[model samples]
Target: MKGKGKKLRKREKAMESGSVEDVLRIDVQNLIVSLNQDNDGVAEGENAAPELETENLPEPGTEIDVKVVELSSTGDGLALHEGSKRVYVVPFSIPGDTVKVKIFRHVLDESYSIADFISVVTPSELRDDSRIGCKYFGKCSGCQFQMMDYSEQLKHKKRIVEKAFRHFSQLPPELIPAIQDTIGSPLQYGYRTKLTPHFDGPPSWRKNREPFTSRPPIGFMLKGTHQTLDIEDCPIGTDVVRLGMKNERARMEVEYGNYTRGATILLRESTRRIPKNESRPSSSPKARSKSPSPLPPDNAAVKVETESYTDVKTCVTSNTATSTEYVGPYVFYNPAGSFFQNNNSILPVFTDYVRQHILPPPSSPSSSPSSSQPIKYLVDAYSGSGLFTITLSSLFSGGSVGIDISDASIKYATENAAANDLPLSRVRFIAADAKDLFTPAIRRAYPGDQTAVVIDPPRKGCDQDFLSQLLRFAPRRVVYVSCNVHTQARDIGVLVRGLEGEGSKGTRYSIESIRGFDFFPQTGHVEGVAVLNRVDE
Candidate 1:
């Protein structure tokens, strides 16, 4: 326990410093390890330099040619240097592509350097620039893998999950299973249901109170810079949200002088159920002529008709306004400003996989022999608006519970369960801290031996306290869903390496599978899900 505590503390200290380069070093090292796994000499590129004079590292702004050997977890290209001790990270470059780059920053302590992509001297077979969808592909910070082929993108994400465990999960290699192929999204582009485009006020405009001669840039931040790029339309956003962006930009132009400071404008797509026979009110000529509509008349107000009802989608700008999204037959409503999955196209596949793996596979009518006791209950941790609980309640014979620290989220989760027509008696929501998850009453109500827990934590991942409680609970199975694979790996590592050698009688967990879902296509972002089964000694 002392050794494990020290290791976790060291990692937490580094994380608290908030240095992106420190995290990148771990990913870069893992990338090099994966590349050379087969001893195939993947690092021996033609342009790779041998152990360089550490003192003679390339000066900042120096131009050099290098062949990319792999891509880091951050979606930057990695090239071997100084015999893999020192590495060069080039943005917007792919492996097997020889590119010219300008050295920008050197992380001497970590033995890696950051470079700006200049031009490709030779392209990788997997590199297809023609596949790029966005006009601001290289310069925009919003996306990283737009220039890459979609199939290759999925493969790279799989590699990212493998590297994540290798680097952050401090477990024996044999304890981990082979990483699964990444699930691809249905829509490669135009899948995002929300977009928050913002613009900064002109410097000192508040004091000057002057009108600008030109329109300010209203878009996302530029890559590697603090400035914003004037993006008129984003291809990644849904059609309704994109139209909202256009309308919002127009409003910003006229109201730029009124703002005291820069602000983010929310454009969240919301859906409402209308009668199948009803005509779209927002699309009517009379409604368009009205002086004030809930949304701009030009903004998309689309009507999708089905046999039972019609779904009308529109973009919501107010933070307090309700935003609706659907995953299969389940509907979810959250504040427009609140966090929800941005890509609706991938929810069906993602949720289905989660449901299938919630418990041990059914080998027979009951449970597998290895898992003698079948899991009949579920606990969805950090469940916002009952995304997992409502969707997964049908599988558990003993019903499910959704828990969150936020009372507002718990309230919404309860309401969402009722709205989805799920039996309130079977589905419940609780607002409580993770540290006090398994109270005496709760333990009696839902026995851990028959319960499966699903955890979907934020990007920072679970803290040590939460992990410790989870280990003590010793549930039948744990399905960890995370956006930040690094933190997920760290947390899972702690759980897998429980206090066995120490004084306590610790329960052990085995990694069943690791898979990534392509929630955001044409981007480096990946959503990872890891399944763990409690081991019987």
Candidate 2:
């Protein structure tokens, strides 16, 4: 392949550590393959036949050595099988991990496989537990990074955010601003306010595991299996939760055979409210704790409630989490198990980032009595539980509108605004179809130089109709919030290539910045926010 009379030398530099760009691609197959190649033992498709017959495929449940080269968005590791014709995913694995795994695949599909970890052959250098490690590190399915150093985990998460944006945007990395460092939780391990510990009926009660015992054991489901790991304490759970479960476990032994099948216990920790100004924009502002005193061990409660949907029984347990908890000055009615952000530690930082971009500081008006109308309106298109609009309504001088496709969400918003004591004159909430969420009154109220729209859609990202309407409305600024960076980048791409008035020009909004908030720590999840500014023709 070398073609040169002068013999040009190839120069290669070692890739910087943890650069996702060098190893990941947008295409799923390519991404899996590249990550698989990063491992040492998983030699890529050496000298194998082009296609293996059904009878020739590797036997299911056979243990083999595989190296995890990349972590999936959901925290699984991507690896490869022999001949490299198919890829396998192993959970509870980090990149650079060489582990023995038992392989299994769907009967009809030989193109993919799933692996269960037998033992770790070589642990990744990123793993750290120098001070102390959790005994449930491998057995429990709760926390993924108990072995990883906290700082290293932060670095990897930032890299994950950057990688996702680039891959989904399908653009050069230079276009997007460098992702900020992951904001860590003040309480890394014991920050969780709620826990759902479960137990399965023994073989005696269920007749599944040969002779069953009828004792209800409490804890998390085992990694890669339906089995539950009995736990007396979980580090990730709050002290309040631990004490609640501890008592419940003792009670379970006394009242044995109460559960005929599988059952779960819900433990919730009651928390105090904090005063609000919690603003973190480009800067990583320190989030203040609500209570100067420590969390009381006895400030916890347990209750059981059952809700059925889609022919499945779901149990939810909630504590006295309330609407008075302030994120900035806004009071959100956070009913237990309703979608208040999980990590209380970084919530102020997260909300402030959203507010800063959505409501920029007021600037001096244009000189010479400019004819251009200055934007005074703010619209929260996807106002879930009214977090954005209520918190920001007072910031906008003219007025604000909050719209939601779900009537329940709008109702919650109304209740929250009233609880926050925000006047009806200052802001209003509307329930309408997302396609027609923005009303003409919005244009009338805030018709000018800098109107802002804040949107936080479900994990799938904003719908196209909403996006198109956003373009037509052409707000001066748009702040898009998403937990899924890939979908966010997809939406960003569409926004970047938006059409101008009557298709007269290209690109209407300039991407101002892309930032990540570490809303969830010790997990794969993160909240990403992007700010886009409309360009005047």
Candidate 3:
């Protein structure tokens, strides 16, 4: 394996020494073979670029025309200069959009540069040229796909997952299960359950404008810059969440002096915040609505909006029936800033999918052959606030235990467990570091022989120790959930292939299924869930 890898690297080096096009082609082909499958311009009559203290960047208004060939994993369109070996990342642009761009950031040694989308010289067919998209589409770093068809976004995301696995994982591509199409978000817009708009230093930029109000600008930050792009409303959030921002601003206006420094405020809406009797306007961009809701209650005020995502004091919420256990709703306390799913509408369906993969229905006599192991115990590692741990605990008779690094998360998880009326005998949560996520007692309770382990780690994926301990304690089945498919694929490789130096077995597990969940519509971010089972002894 080492010799083959060295030979592959040598071949890649040779290719790099050749034409840039050859290097790119080979790199792309390898991604498919491995598992695989696979800007610019500004010119003319365009709005002049914003002036700034020019540094080592291209002239503040310099226009460079280029053709966008593809999109980076982050969803930024990429234009390659084969002759110069230069790559430019143009945000809010899509593949096949030939455009002239105004370069904003350029560091020669970095081998690439950043540019703002100026004008589309020849638009891509995938481009949604409705011209009625988000007003802040490009300037605000919020939604990247306002001009992209949602279907195209899903296609690009599916390819992103493929590239992640092909480029990062250590296992053979043939061993990977079929990659499924990305599950689209039911509510593409107005689905965000949370909203956090912040302010920066005193309105220095706005001071020059005539009749400037003392009120600090409120909205999202400009793309790739710290400057705030104040707005009257945000289209992505629910009507309640967006309209409530005005009330928050009103409250902040009165208490503006209380804010001595820049801070991001929080406003979360429980999808259930609005009663069932009310109608939820369609999330389609075509049906984008700005209907207002009553002002948020006075208590919605945030105190000391500190850096740790302070204050859920006002806009607290509960999960809707569809997103949690059918028998009960899991109520999470959001004061401590624990993470939760953003797209509420699809969460229940998403969790249902997870449940489906984790538990294949009992094989009936007449049913097709499908292998399944009835799991007794469950370990929800990285179980922040115990969402999965508490919700899925009742399924396993031997009981379930959750582990998280944050004490706040564990505390809230404990409260949530009680709130959901989860039996203590069957549910538990532990706050521990990565190494201690699984302890002797937790292990003892679950006699690993018949256990199921579900993990949802951050984008970087699992660490070596977690992978080592996971394999060492060999659960009967594993359900790995990740938002970053690249890292998920990398961790999947480590799990399937085991450690590089410690060759204990040919393969420890086999992929049962893989699927993607589109959590953030109009953006590149995606969530993926994969299931695997241990090879029988």
Model 2 weakest 10-residue run by lDDT:
5-14
Ranking by lDDT: 1, 3, 2
Better of 1 and 3 by lDDT: 1
Better of 1 and 3 by TM-score: 1
Each prediction's whole-model lDDT (CA) = 0.79, 0.63, 0.66
Residue-wise lDDT of candidate 2 within 300-352, one digit each (tens)? 43322224101111112543333224454444555554565656556777776
The number of the candidate with the highest lDDT is 1
Any residue pairs clashing in model 1, and if so which? none
Model 2 RMSD in Å is 11.5
Which candidate's TM-score is highest? 1
RMSD of 1: 5.4
Give per-residue CA lDDT, model 3, range 1-537, as digits (tens). 655444533433332221223223333333223221122333322113222222344564578777777777776777743333356678888878888898886644344567888888888888866833578887888878888878888988888777666656646679887789999988888777687888875554355333324667888989888889887788778665776687778876777665545777776653222223335422111222546334335455332233422222234433221121111244554442346776666877887777777754466121112224356888999988777886687788888888899887787677767766786788888888877666677778876666889999876677766876787677767999998776687677767764322332323677888878899988878898989877654
Query: Using alpha carbons, what is the TM-score of model 1?
Result: 0.87
Native-to-model Cα distance after best TM-score fit, residue 330 in candidate 1, in Å: 0.7
Clashes of 2: 7
Question: What residue pairs are clashing in model 2?
Answer: 203-212, 204-212, 373-449, 374-449, 375-448, 375-449, 375-450
Q: Please give, for residues 1-537, the per-residue lDDT of candidate 1 as tens digits.
A: 668756654664454211245457666655544555446756554223333336778799999888888777788888754344467888888889899988888866455788888898889988889888888888888888877888899999998888778767767789879999999999998889989988877788689756655568989998778999999999999888888898898887787667656778899998765445654432221222344335334336766678966667889999988787778878787888888899999998899999999978766243345367778999899998899999999999898999898888898788778777787779999999877876677778887788999999998888766776777677889999999887888778877876543322476688889999999887778899999987767
